[model samples]
Target: MEVRVLPGEHFYGFLRFYGKGITFPKGHVESGETYEQTALREVSEETGYKNLEIVKSLGVVTRPAIETDGTEVIKDIYLFLMKITGDDKGKAEEETEWLTIDDALTRLMPQEVEFLKKIQLEIYED
Candidate 1:
């Protein structure tokens, strides 16, 4: 996930084009790619952030959803808090934004919103 601290106090998340709401950089784990490598690649692909430093793994989150085939799908998402090394640059493949955490929450799906809040507490709260 790509996150930027706005003015050193507020947190901003990247909003993707197809994801319907504000989301961190994410993508499938390609064959021959480590999860960490995928995460780094996704961040760069979706948000144009190249120099990333993974702060820590926030672990995995799982949720159930129904696919178009009506099959129950259990999605496991690996969460990471990362910092970018240089000023954000490059053209993203999709529309992207660095929105404030509160604003991002407003644009997130219900389940994702809760997950983001948990991340916020874990990172920002004692």
Candidate 2:
């Protein structure tokens, strides 16, 4: 998810929409890259924010499906509770909308919010 945190007691998230289906700002963990590394790189590339920090790990999302060519593919994606620790220096295309944290609770799909909340609460923990 591409996010921006205002200097307030609270912050929000932004939605990255490509089409009818919303796409998350993430990528497969590359060779020699840890889960956090991949998350940082993906967020930076997708959102153009350079200073990103993995506040915590969210979890893993796996999709095992058969490719169109008949080969079976198992896609395992790692998720994280990442934060924007730098300036929002880059501008995104018009398709990108700030997915407000409050709105995220309501606008996001149930499973998506549930899936993310499981790991994101760490930011509020002691």
Candidate 3:
């Protein structure tokens, strides 16, 4: 997920999946692409904001997930701290919204909420 501070508040970028609900932007890494590169591209594609810079690595989250075909798998999600670097905008390919920490905590999945809460203080200090 990406967070940016504007005036008095910090906002998180979230994508609304049609049947899956809201979550951060994520995608499979393309050939020859690093995890950071994939994150930057996916965020830009889903949020329509091209200007972003990675501030730091936020660690990783490994979880069990069921695929559309009912296959279960373990997924490793790499999290990063990123910030908006410019005002460039375009039409988003997916439904996207910028929400405050409190709103995001309520709307995100339990696992994700835990992750966010763990870094909440760090975000505030930035």
Using lDDT as the measure, name the better of candidate 1 and candidate 2: 1
RMSD of candidates 1 onward, in order = 3.1, 4.1, 2.1
Model 1: residue 55 alpha-carbon error in angstroms: 1.0
Model 1 poorest ten-residue lDDT run: 1-10
C-alpha lDDT of candidate 3 relative to the true structure: 0.80
lDDT of 3 by residue, 40-72 (tens): 998888888899898877777666767889999
Which wins on TM-score, candidate 2 or candidate 3? 3
Candidates' C-alpha lDDT: 0.72, 0.60, 0.80
- Among these predictions, the greatest lDDT belongs to 3
TM-score of each: 0.76, 0.63, 0.85
Segments of candidate 2 deviating more than 4 angstroms: 1-15, 18-20, 63-74, 88-95, 105-111, 120-126
**Cα lDDT for residue 83, model 1?**
76
Candidate 1 shows a clash count of 0
For candidate 1, the TM-score is 0.76
- 2 or 3, greater by lDDT: 3
